[model samples]
Structure formats: structure tokens, C-alpha cells
Target: MEAETVSKKWEGKVSAGLPIPTTAAQVWPFLEDFCNLHKWLPSVDTCYQVDGISGQPGMIRYCAATITASSTSSGRDETMIKWAKEKLLTIDPIKRCLSYEVLDNNVGLKSYVATMIVLPIDGDGIHGCKIEWSFVSDPIEGWRLEDWVSFLEPSLQSMAKNIQDALLLL
Candidate 1:
């Protein structure tokens, strides 16, 4: 009997950038923490370290995200919950970038890897920064590549706004 091969190649890619009113120095602090995604990602209700140490490679984080959709037929809103366990693959403080892979997820994302980078914006007297997020994953059931990009762009924008608002409070 022949053994079946499992392919782990990423089939879809999506990326987006959001301009933040704060500098990279400030943004890096938020992203480098590794277990505080719920602070900025509006849809993520909870995120915590599941294993290893925070901000270090080999660490894993468990996140629970919720999405509410209005149902016209039912005259109510439906809430969906997604859970994912992601492992930290790499961290580069000098470049203000980190990479992570999804080890397990209930959302049907397979072989998922994502990278986030905080880029400093200089010149024109602009002191803010931009957050660049990119990811690759295997094809998800009932979702197209464009759908993933569209969904993420707004999420990144919201996250940037949340970061800015949090900084203002400080």
C-alpha cells in the first residue's frame, strides 16, 4: 500500500498596509507583545499565550474572534465565533517585523503564515508609521482570495485606528 502525501503549500496571498499616526517606536511596542492582538483587532474578543514565552520564537497564542452579521430574514443578528492557535515563527526587533504560522484553526485556514511589519514614515514632517500585514494560506472553503483581502483591509484599518486611540489615551 502507498502512503498518501499531504501538501502544505500556501495557495492564497493577501496583504495590506495601514497608516498610523504614531511612530514605529510606539507601534512596535504593541505588536511585539505577541499576545495582545485583542487590544487592536476589533473582531478578536480574547487572545492569550497558550505556550512558551511571549515575544519569543516557538511561542503559541490562542485567539477567539467573533463576527456578527445582521439577518434580514430572521430579524436578528447572528454571531459566529472562530478559534485559532498560532505559533510564532520569527521575530526581528531591528526591522520591526514578526512572522507567525497557524498551527491549528477552526476557520479552515491551512498552512497559514503571516508577517507584520512596522515601517517608519519619514520626510514631509510626517512622524507617523505604517503597519504592513501580509499572509499566505491554503484555499479556504467558500472564500475567495479577494474576499480575504477585502476582509483584512478593513480589519487592519480598524486596528490602526485602535492603536492611535490607545496612544492618545497615554
Candidate 2:
């Protein structure tokens, strides 16, 4: 099938409340494992090391994080790329907070920032986690604003659902 290129400046987040019987520190590892992205991200088919570092600056990896309504002429699949530019700005394990950025050249983002904040919700003592996602990016050459949102919105929504579901199951 022919591939329709997708380029966009997107900034969005997909997070849900994870049930914790213990401390927020306990679940931090699962959230931080970069290679374990597919476990939390439903759209992700597989993730592998391409080159450079991972979960750090100048890290290179390929992620098959694509989905399609049907497996037909037009579909989405992760491209085997050189690298994903996600430089960790800050990672507060105790607070369950992380900040990252990706540039256009490496990951193809004119400008982008993604922050994940995890905090306790209700004092049920059972431990409730809250994740807040934020981002912004410049559109790519073949990518447009409208299509970008259209492409990412559903993915983000599903991502949130998958994360929540994972928590439920695990």
C-alpha cells in the first residue's frame, strides 16, 4: 500500500488515573521505561533501538506507533527512522513528573515540549495518580494543522484509554 505522508505540529497528552496500592515511586519505573512504550501505548506495535542513547538527549529509536481504521490502501505504521529526539528536561521520580522536547531535524518537530505530571488525586489511601500532558509543535512540510489534529486526537484518546486500561488490568 502507498503511504500518505503525515506532517504536523502537534501538542497533546493522554493520561489516566492509575490505581496504586503503595507509593507513587513504585509505579515510576513502568512509566519511565522508554522501551516499554508499546505496553502503555496501544497504537505502538513495536519499539527498538536505532542508534545513540535512549530516554536521553541524542537518543535514536524507531517506534511502530500507527493505527488505521482498516488494513487497506491507506494506513499508518511507524517508520524505521534514525532517532527520536526526546531530551529529558527534568524527571522528578518522587513527584512522577517528566519534561521533554523534540526538534524538527531529529524527530521532525519545529518546536515541541511535552510534560507529564503525576500526582495523587484523592486521599483514599489506596493511592490515586493523575497525569497531565502538555505540548506544542510546528507543522511539517507535508503535514497540516487540521489533519495533524485529526490524526493525533484519536491516537491520543486511545492512548489515554490504553494507559488507564493497563492500570486496571495490571
Report the C-alpha lDDT of model 2 over 123-144, residue by residue, as the tens digit.
4436656555666776655766
Question: Which parts of model 2 have CA positions greater than 4 angstroms off?
Answer: 1-14, 19-23, 51-58, 66-85, 104-108, 123-127, 139-170
Query: Where does model 1 exceed 4 Å of error?
Result: 1-21, 69-78, 123-127
Worst 10 residues of 2 by lDDT: 77-86
For each candidate in turn, the TM-score is 0.82, 0.57
Top candidate on TM-score is 1
Candidate 2 lDDT at 4 equals 65
TM-score of 2: 0.57
Residue range 123-160, candidate 1, lDDT tens digits = 33166778888887876778877788788888888888
Pairing residues by index, what is the TM-score of model 1?
A: 0.82
Angstrom error at residue 66, model 1: 2.5
Instruction: State the C-alpha lDDT per candidate.
Output: 0.83, 0.58
